[model samples]
Structure formats: structure tokens, C-alpha cells
Target: MTDAPDRPNGGSSRGLWILIYCLLVPAVVVPLLVPLYDKAGPTLFGFPFYYWFQFALIIGAAILTLSAYVVSTKADARERAARLERRDRR
Candidate 1:
């Protein structure tokens, strides 16, 4: 009753969501991890563990988010190419 290529797009669009989840790892990790760093055992440039940990989290979050963007962009580009190829074949 239905063609193979006409199947629903399920796994075909999973990359963006996977990328989003990857970035969310840091957001979730920081809140839970920060409590453990609420002491001054380590110091960076005179800042206590609490302060330096926040800075490191900021940088790490940024990197994770940037990587997510790149991954999603690549996924989108691949989708576009697939569409174009199907159109050409038709």
C-alpha cells in the first residue's frame, strides 16, 4: 500500500536532538557538580574552588553548545542533499 521511500522520517532527523542532548549534559552536570565544589580546597589565580569551577563550567558549556551547532548544521546539510538527490532522480 505504501512505497519504501515514502516511509515516515523517524531516525532520519535524530541528529539534531542528539546534539541538543549532548549540550544539555553540561547544563545538567554543572548544577549537580557545583555543590561538590563549594569548598576552597583548590584555588586558581586566588579564586576559590567555587569561583574557578564556575568559570570552567562556562567554558565547557560553550564548547559543548558550539559542537552541537556544528553537528546539527551537518545533519541539515545532509538532509538537503538527500532531498536534492531525490528530486533529481524524479
Candidate 2:
């Protein structure tokens, strides 16, 4: 057999990676789409929509990035454990 460790539920792990990408993509993409928040009306406490929305985006991005980080760490840990188990079997 190959040296590569067997991943139980490999498809699930692939899905998890896809989920991680989905979590991260909005954090990077939404803010770059400037026109989405380029507005002056609908102020929050005298802050324009453009300004407040940017702040909100910063918070949203932080949460999304944090979520991605947590998911990736767990996935990495699982893969590492599987690799160790496979090596031990040899």
C-alpha cells in the first residue's frame, strides 16, 4: 500500500474544506466590492451608511475568518491523528 494515510470519510473532510473556503471567501470578497456599501444615506448615529457598513464588514470578516480558523484547526488535527494512527499500524 502507499504511504499515504487512509482518511476515514474523506469526502466529508473535503466538504469541510469546502465549507472553510465558503466561510473565508465572503470575508475577502464582500469588502472589495466597494459599490455595495458606497452610500451616504441611512446613517447610524450620524455615521453614513458607507462608513457604518465598512465597520460592520470589518466585524463580519473577523467572525468569518475566526470561524474558518477554528474549522481548519480541527480538520488539521483530525488528519494528523489519522496519519499517526496509520504510521503506528506499520
Q: Whole-model Cα lDDT per candidate?
A: 0.74, 0.84
Among all windows of 10 consecutive residues in model 1, the one with the lowest summed lDDT is 4-13
| lDDT per residue (tens digit) for residues 1-90 in model 1 | 766563134435566767778777876777586568889968988998888887887788788878878887877876776687688879
Candidate 1 RMSD to the correct structure: 4.0
Q: What TM-score would every model get versus the actual structure?
A: 0.68, 0.84
Mind sharing the TM-score for model 1? 0.68
Error of 1 at 56 (Å): 0.5
Every model: Cα RMSD to truth: 4.0, 2.9
Model 2 over residues 1-90: C-alpha lDDT tens digits?
Answer: 797546653523566788899999999999899988898999999999999999999999999999999999878877777767768888
Which clashing pairs does model 1 show?
Answer: none
Q: Which runs in model 2 stand beyond 4 Å of their true positions?
A: 1-6, 9-12
